[model samples]
Target: MDVVALIGRILFVVLFLGSGFAHLTQTEAMSGYAASKGVPAAKLATQITGVMMIIGAVMILLGVWSDLGALLLVVFLIPTAVLMHAFWKETDAQAKQMEMIQFQKDLALGGAALLLFALYAKLGDDLGLTITGPLFK
Candidate 1:
């Protein structure tokens, strides 16, 4: 069961992990797009969120302070979804659809992060994992 849970955690974090890598590797391109979207300090924000995503995903995968990791993701996802995927502001039909899809995806992921936090809070000890850690303390 622990092995299964670990595998699930790894799978869940793959999107964030890959995205974090992309944000770091493609900072200039990503920041440029962000700037187009009126994100202040676009480059810095990109880098900071990238680091947050990587750290959060790692913490969740290791089952160490997973709640904090989930919270990090929730924080990153909400504004990101609104700022980056403002479908209602799009005029082009196709573009609006694409943005809407992205928005929904982000929302779903955020919900998953919230659920992860709740689960960790409730079952962390039962799962034979340390939910509270030095970071959380």
Candidate 2:
């Protein structure tokens, strides 16, 4: 069960871990896209969120303060979904569908993060294979 939990943790974090790296490494390109979406201070915001993603992902991956990590991810996801994936703003049908998909994806991932936050808060120590218990409790 512990191993299974660990594996689940690893799998859950892979997207964030990889995307975090891309956020940092491809800041210029990502920022350009962000600016296109009307994100102010796009470059700085991109860099900051990149760091946030990496840090949050690491915390969850290592089971150290995972609740806070989940919160961080939730924070990142909400604005991202609203500001970046505003499907209603799209004029093209295909683009609208794509944005809507991304928006839904973010919402689903954010919900999962919230669930993990609550889980870690309730089962901090018993979660197994953890470096430290959840930060909240």
Candidate 2, 31: how far from true, in Å?
0.2
Candidate number with greatest lDDT: 2
lDDT for model 2 comes to 0.93
TM-score of 1: 0.92
Candidate 2 structure, TM-score to reference: 0.97
lDDT of 2 by residue, 1-137 (tens): 78988898898889999899999999999999999999999999999899888998999999889899999999999899999999999999999999999999999999999999999999997986889988896
Model 1 Cα lDDT, one tens digit per residue, 88-131: 99999999999999999999999999888887776774544444
* Cα deviation of 74, candidate 1, in Å: 0.6
Worst 10 residues of 1 by lDDT: 128-137
Best by TM-score: 2
For candidate 1, what is the lDDT?
0.87
